[model samples]
Target: RIERLEEEKKTISDDIKDVFAEAKGTGFDTKAMRSIIRLRKKDQAERQEEESILDLYKAALGMV
Candidate 1:
């Protein structure tokens, strides 16, 4: 069962890679897309907290 699940996971990973590759071929920003996907996985409060911290760090670095 574990091996089968691992194989399935590999297949999904490969599919994601292919999608990213296709997006890249079309001149899409895959890294940004990945970040958006990651952010979407978080709840609104979690996202807000992360964004707040990021803004603070940017301000500290004078990037903002």
Candidate 2:
């Protein structure tokens, strides 16, 4: 069962690589795109956490 799962995972990974290669052929840098995606997700999460903290602070001060 585990071996089958591993093979499936590898197949999926290869498919992803092929897709990225196709995108690269269209003049896109997959690495840069991936980096940008990672950074945007991280930034969004950080912004959300910051906003949550700000909301808590405001509520503590009876402002909201």
Model 2 residue runs over 4 Å out of place are 40-43, 47-64
**Tens digit per residue, CA lDDT, model 1, 1-64:** 9999999999999999999999999999999999999999999999999999999999999998
List residue ranges in candidate 1 displaced over 4 A.
none
Query: Using TM-score as the measure, which candidate wins?
Result: 1
lDDT of each: 0.98, 0.89
Q: What is residue 30's positional error in candidate 2, in angstroms?
A: 1.2
Cα error, residue 42 of model 1, in Å, equals: 0.4
Q: Give the TM-score of candidate 1.
A: 0.91
lDDT of 2 by residue, 1-64 (tens): 9999999999999998898999899999999988767667777778789779999999999999
**What TM-score would every model get versus the actual structure?**
0.91, 0.58
